[model samples]
Target: MFDITVLGCSGGTLEVGTSAYLVKSSRVAYQEILERELTDEIVAVDCGSGLAKLCEIVYDELCGEGDSMATKSLSFYTKDQVSCLEKFTSRGIKRVGMQLDTQCESTPMQVAWKLNHMVKNYLLTHPHLDHCSGLVINSPSFGAHSGKRVHGLDSTCKALGENVFNNVIWPDLTASDKGSCLQLCSMEDHVPKAINSTYTVTPFKVKHGELTSSESYASTSFVISHRVLKRSILMFGDLEADDPDTPNEGLNWKIWQHVAPMIVDGSLRTVMIECSTPNVDANQPLYGHLTPATLFQELLRLRDMVRSLNGSETLEGLEVLITHIKHENAMIPDPREVILGELTELKTLHNLEVNFTILLPGQTYTVS
Candidate 1:
């Protein structure tokens, strides 16, 4: 089982909520977490938003001291959706609440400070600012002394080393010397690397979009697995649909082929993917992102692949958590609602059996 906490999930247009997630094996007890006994265990999938959001969660939801900002954050969600969030969050609330009570002298910031230190490995998909700003901003607190490792593809690591952490936009923290805080580790495609004793992550390269007419931007999707249980969650970075006009158009198909067997074997059931916009004109520039219509098409491809493997065309038991909705304008309908409505219409139109949920920040989900 994996417990995933949404630190932030927006694609852009907001600073406080971007695309960060905290993932941990359910085996770690809350008491053990409070005691700070684990090492190299907590894994941060992305760090677009971090400590500040954690502080908000602790203060408003767990401590119940603030003006219910945490609850207000979910105002767009339906009551049933909010109830689901509460159900998932309730699993850890009691233990976390107990820990909060014991640390009465510690303000929310202090508690969040200590909690943030538990993350020893950061798995980055790309070097986009929205996906890594928190990692860059929060490096000073734990990186220098803790020896935290940032794992990503060679291209991703190289970009961070040369562009972001090269003493201009940020300090030179990518060195292995004692003064540096972060160590960049390059990962091989499709090879699983152990994050800790309990979890392993396999990276798959996908095409994000075009950087130039001849050059394409690359992002990644990760298969995070429980070593013993064999259960996995597939998490994707920003990506465009497989357009034949684009280079590497079929890369998403390769990912679908790779995971179809896992789905058939029942080792993978949850997929967290990005849908950056609602349905838009086909000619509109996506800038390497997905819309609900495009995302549904991709899901149909996966369903077809699963059918070819197991003669099962329906992804009935699968959970699809949509992430990274880019809020565009205040005059328009809320993008989340627009995307959700479109997805619902498509699902019903085609009788697709997947369960789709829009991810909200400050929520926790337990997937088994």
Candidate 2:
């Protein structure tokens, strides 16, 4: 069975103990299973702290401890604050932030802090709150406001270890005593504490077509080699490319050909690619997103490329899991499944030999 667990595909955290989940490849040893693996540390790709509410906390401080404020949009703090206001936080929340948004199917607002805690390593696909909010280590607020940003919280840069939480967009969480203004984390902060694993995480910027070329959501790709469990799952936060000016115009295949082959170059056990829509849906997949049809075409193209390269590594029967379905085409009952069904049928017809799975909400698949 898969050690993975899906919290939500297109929305909210499943109620605790809900069993609407899947386990794909669970082959852990008796002792491994006896010892809980998931823990409380997280790897966040993005953090979107609401400003109006955050400022209100500072506003309350200026107004005086019990002083009431007119409006409190939302503060990025814990729930133990003053009267009439509740903090927006999860007990296990981490302060790891990045320069992106969150996943559409992202509900926990985190990628998961503790994946089998016995293994302390972590990986995040890109900068997005839905994927990273669960792991943010800290936020940077001015000390004048309260001796520290989100005052007195231990989520400062040093406390987080190797970061200067980017002051460009978010405040510098590092203390002035640390000698840095910015507070963003470096690559070192991502590796796990132990477990004798060869896991490595790397990010590469990818340009999507016009349809997906929005600013706040620029796409970045993630390649994680989870050496411990011998698992590797690659996914981009959220992605898209601009369809040409013409409605019928599609992604530039020539450019894609150049990059596609390289994507499989990395050695991995399993690769989770994001396929968000059906080809007829019109959005370009792979810029940071993938439509079922586009994904089909891309895979075929990739298979052919691999054959031509004369490489023995064939994904013909390789397990390929698809994630990040758009609200319209997702397996869920939204209005978009009409065309989605057609696209899924096409995939079935191809019977591409590769293990294809459309990840469901709360679903977990093994890594075999």
lDDT of 1: 0.78
* lDDT scores in order: 0.78, 0.37
Best-fitting candidate, scored by lDDT: 1
lDDT of 2 at 348: 72
C-alpha RMSD of each candidate structure in angstroms: 3.9, 14.6
Model 2 segments beyond 4 Å from truth?
Answer: 11-122, 136-184, 187-197, 208-217, 228-231, 241-269, 279-288, 311-314, 328-332, 335-340, 348-351
Instruction: Give the TM-score (vs. native) of candidate 1.
Output: 0.89
Task: Tell me the deviation in Å of residue 336 in model 1.
Answer: 0.7
**Number of clashing residue pairs, candidate 2:** 56
Q: How well is each residue in 124-224 modelled by candidate 1, as lDDT tens digits?
A: 99999999999899887775657688899999999999999988999887666656687889999989999777779999988898999988898999998
TM-scores, all candidates, are: 0.89, 0.49
